[model samples]
Structure formats: C-alpha cells, structure tokens
Target: MKKLSVSILYAILSVAPIAGAQGDIAAQVVPQVLSRSPEEIRPWRAPVFADQSAALGYNESAFSIPKGMEKQVQFWIDVYTKYTTEQGVIHDAENVETVYEIVDLKGLKTEREKQKKVDEVKKIIAARLSTPEEGERLRFQLGQKDRMQDAIFYSGRYLEDMEKIFRDSKVPVELTRLAFVESSFNIMARSKVGASGIWQIMPYTARPYKMISPVVDKRNHPLEATKLAAKLLRQNYSMLESWPLAVTGYNHGPTGVLKMTKSYETRELGELIQNVRSRKSFGFASRNFYASFLAALEVEKNANKYYGSVVWSKPLPAQDLKLPVSVKYKEIVSWFDGDDSKAQVYNPHLTHKARKGHPIPAQTVISVPKDKYNVALISLARKDRTVAMEDKKGR
Candidate 1:
C-alpha cells in the first residue's frame, strides 16, 4: 500500500517553534484553506493491505466502523494491542494511518529525556515533510498506549451490569465497551478535568442525569454511572442521528460536533473528521474518538485472540437497599461489624461528607452484600423508626 502524502505538512511547521514542544504540531495548525467545499476535500480511500487475514471483521451491528474509517480504527488497534506504555508512535495527527516511526523509550530515565527523543524524531519528520520527495510523513506524537488488556480483565466486574443498563434504557448494548476507551474500566478513575468513573462523564454532563450531588457523585459507581451514560449516549444519538457522531460527542461536546457537521456541510463522520479544519475545540482527540472506540470494541470482542486465555474479574454480588431515612455512613458500616473497607467497596459513591458522619440523604439506594442484606435491612429499619420517634417527640 502506498503512503498518503502529507500535503498540509508545511502548514504545521509555519506555526510556533518546536522548542520544548509537548503537543502535536498537526493539532495546532489551522489550515489557510478552511473555505474549501466538502467536495474539494478528497474523500478517504480504504487502504489496500497485502494480508486480508489482518483486515477488520465486518458486522451489520450499529457500531460497525465505516469503510473510510478502517485505517484509523486499525491504527488505534495497533496502539492498544501492539504498543505498550514504554513506547510511543510519531505519526500524522490528521491522517492517523501515516506513521513516521515508533520510538522505544524504555531506557529513557526522565520524562524530559523521553520528550527530547520524541522532539528529535519530530525534527526528522519536519525535515522529511519539508522535502516531500524524501517520503510520506507528517506531525504528531502519541505516547499514551491503551491498557486494553487490563481494561478487559476488569470489565468482567461491570460488563454484565452495563449491558443490562443500556438494554433497559433501549440503547445499544455494545456501547458498554466504551468504558475501555473512556477509562479502561477503572472504576476509581478521575480525570484532571473532573470527568469521573469508567464513563469519564463531566460534572456538567452528568448533572442533568442526577448523577452528581453533594452527598454522592454516582459517577464513581460503575452501575449507576452506566445508567447515566446510556441516557447521555441515547440523547447524543437522537441529536446527531449517527452512532459515530454520538460516540465522538461523548468526548467532544455534542454541540461542538453538531457545529462541525454544519460548518463542514457533511453528516458523514468520516468526511467531517477528514476535512474539518483544525481548531481548539475539535482537535486530534475528538477526531479519533470513534476510531479508538471501534478499536476497543474489536479488541475486546476478540480478547482471546489478542490476549490469549484471560481471567476476568467476577461480577460483584450485592443487593440494593434503599435507605428509609437519612443515615450516617459509619452506622451503615456498623451493620457489617464495622467493616469500613467492605462498606466502601460496595457503596463506592459515598461522598466525604457522608463518610464524616453527615447524613446520607434519604431514599439513597446503596449496595450491600447479598448475604448481609437482611441484617442490614433490619438495622436500617430500626434506625428509621428511632429517627421517626424522635421527630414525633419534637413535634
């Protein structure tokens, strides 16, 4: 297969100097020809590969990757399965398929040293880009490799529950695999930007779903978060009318994606991603979001092929108990012989205030071990009656 030329490579170099650069230049460049019509922007041609055996599997599923996006999805599959944290790939940010090289940084001691090596590679790529006859190369440095293997291992803990949530909500069950791309099924994961849980939902986005609160941010709870994520995804699909755009909206705001669709005059996600001029809001991450998701789905669907025999974490066994009245966290822990750790493990959504003896709001449904549900219910009932009696006496 012939490599696609980086026609706009020089546009990227015209920006800022490469000194101590940490971000991709391709992402920074705003092409001068943003006025070009959608038809003027060449459509993506599926890359021809020598081995048909390595081609992506096709299914009539709702989440199937578009033909134009196969190369991008395949690139992400390599990032997830072929690469590890110790390595990084230098490639075109716009055209994910055009790879400059993959540099191994195992021996690099510090982040500064690793970045310096990456910058050196970028300089070479720049030179190559300047001289188009040298070869096909462009700009971008992606180092964060997917922990898909770990994600697959942990997904067993919540995949069944997530499927039920989406199914009950009438959303596509396969969208549950999005956890792999969002947070790698790391239940405790929280982003610097305040997106939390396996879904990586922002506080603002989760607010409408009632997932965020002072007493509990349900976004940290895998099952609860999955329900909200399902609703949010459905909302996105309703607005965009495309699974690819809806998934992209999960990363980039739906409004932004809608704006891009209008600006580019195309609803085809492949066309929007391929032709949309670079900007601050919809950049590399947004463009590749769906591709990464499709990659995750493929890798997870064929886990045994990518990762051999795997031991998946067992789903937690628990029963949901709704609190009759506001109760303290420690009191709930007392029901299980003061096993704070066990209590926390089951109800991971409790806030700091709840932990510090502040009352958990009434009607809050908490999970407790199935075996201990009866005893916990008894204790909760007794506590509720006592509170009621105190209120009656005060009245």
Candidate 2:
C-alpha cells in the first residue's frame, strides 16, 4: 500500500501504519505526573480548573481524562497545541508515551522524501528493538501535529451553533469539540475513505440521517452536520452508555465497540484498549479516539493559553427559509440581489448538480442573509406564483 500522509494519519479513520515500520520495537519509558485524586478521575467529575466556568459551553464535568490514558491524552494535547504541521513524532504505536524522536519535515521538497525519512527512522527503531540490550518489543507509530490554530479560527463560525444543536439534542455539548479531532473544523475536509465535513462522517453512516443526497450533502455543511452528529452520538451513548465508548464509536462503529466490550467483558475504555488484541478492525485509531477527543477538549478550552489571544471568526448571521417551490441556485442568488458569492457562502450544502442550474427541491431549507430574508422570501413567493400562472396558461 502507498504511504499515508501525516494529515491522513490523524483523521478519524483506521489507516495502515507507515511503510517498513515494523512491529516489536523497544519502548523508551517516559515519566508522568499524576495530579488528580482517584475520586476525581471519574468521567462525570467537575472541571479540574475552577476559574474557567462554562469553559466548554456546557456542563464541564461530563467527560474526564481516563486515569491510565492521561499520558496518551497529553501526547495528543501536545500534537494539537505544541507542534505544527511541519513536524511529526516517531513513537511506539501501542506505547504512545514512548516517543523516540520529533522529525522536522519542513525542508523536505516532496511527500516521498518525507516518507523516506520516516521509514529510515522506523528501521533504526526496529533495529534497536532487535538488539538484546533493548529487551522489549513494540509497534512503531507516526503522529502528525494538527493545524490547530487554523481549526480554532474556523471553529468560530460554527462553535456556538454546534453547542446549541448538541444541547437541544440532549447530547453532551462538549462533544462538539470532536470536530477538532476529526477534521480540525475544516469544512472541506474529505478523508480517503469518503468521510467528509467538519464531523468527518462516512457516507454509510450519514445515509440513515438523510445527510447525503443528490441535491445536497449536508455532511459538508457545519450546522446541518452537527445536528446529525448530535443525533448519532446520542444514539451511540444510548447503546454503549459510556461517553468514551460512544465517542470511540464515532470513529469505530458502535457495533464494533459493542463487540469489543463483550469480548473483553468490560465497559471500561482504558481496560478494553489495554487488553483487546489489535487488528485491522480495532487498531490505533479506534484505541486513541477518546484520548484525542479529551486532548482536543482540553486544548480548545484553554486555547488562549496555548495560542495567545486568538481572534475568532464571528458566527455567521443567516435566516433559514423553507422553499415553497423548487428553485434554481441562480434564482436563489437573484433573490439575494445577484450576490452569488454570498449566496454560495450561505448555501455550502448545495451539490454540483444544484449549482448547475438544477432546481433545489421544494421544502429545502435555504440559508439567506438575515437582513435580506424578508425581501428574499417575498421574491421567492412572487416567482413561485408567476411560474404557477405560466404553467396554468400553457395547460
């Protein structure tokens, strides 16, 4: 198989490890500090930081970092906050805390050159493991740092709306931060396996929610995608009854997670990850899904501390108008006084066919600028009536 890019490695999908990265490498142990009390380790406990009230825009107590997984979570936190996209960490796959080196790929002219460098590091690590002096075996992993600053900046457009959707759906509003892990809040992000949008939902997963269709693929629309994601997460939680498992279920299917729970005879996420046999189905991505989420949550909540004084984009202001009749994309733009750019911005969900003069189906909720909503609605009504009269005359 071809080498996976660093960006592809971090997406919420189970991809193969980089080429020539052998298993059974040695782990370089790293020390960790345990600050929280045993009682406070529970997932439902209140925020550890007292000053940032409503820090995540929800009940901050619902999701805590699992005890044994703190190092893993911290590793991801560094990936998001400390490192940039130009750098990647070469580490033990199973033992994530045992990072061997941080490779700087900034000067590499091409992806092939970068992969060559990564493969060389992997071979050296594998050779060390082969030596009797190392005396331990491990699998190698390449961890890519996210473009978190950009993610956080883009998140400003939909964060409040996402929180509201999750809140109204009765799902944990903090789960909205999953976008940071999945696609770094990049609206146009599309995974190799066909997961799309800020939520990174697969087509199969989105079909039931009616999020993918001929006229529009709501998976690319931040707010619409959030509504579906909230519902899917709520269902997963309802089934698994554990936020860790439910969130993991977002990346690995809930059914697969349910099987792992049964196989391991435990609902404790840390235990399952530690004990379950790694395979093609439930590998690194599934194991680290929740840890990455916790990492994202912590990093995003304390964004200012990590990234000094971020100026977030304002929430887009628009009104949703349910169409009374099928209308072409240009017609909608006409209603917006021919500001095609603004019309496109407000309707990111429109598919290529819809944009190519095809009529958007009736009853579709079209977003229009809040200020222009009244006039747009009037214009649409007038156009619909005129079309009806023309059809009657033809008949």
- Which stretches of candidate 1 lie above 4 Å from their native place? 1-61, 105-146, 276-281, 335-342
RMSD of 1: 13.7
Candidate 1 per-residue lDDT, tens place, 306-386, comes to 766644655556788898888889878875567665566567688667888877988999987777789988887888899
Clashing pairs in 2: 24-138, 25-138
lDDT of each: 0.67, 0.67
User: What number of backbone clashes does candidate 2 have, counting pairs of residues 3 or more apart or in separate chains?
Assistant: 2
- TM-score each candidate: 0.76, 0.78
Residue 327 CA displacement from its true place in model 1, Å: 2.3
- Which residue window of length 10 is worst by lDDT in model 1? 1-10
Residue ranges of candidate 2 with Cα displaced over 4 Å = 1-61, 131-146, 276-280, 333-343, 371-375
Question: Against the hidden true structure, what lDDT does model 2 obtain?
Answer: 0.67
Best by TM-score: 2
How well is each residue in 153-179 modelled by candidate 2, as lDDT tens digits?
Answer: 557667877877866776766788888
Pairs that collide, model 1: none
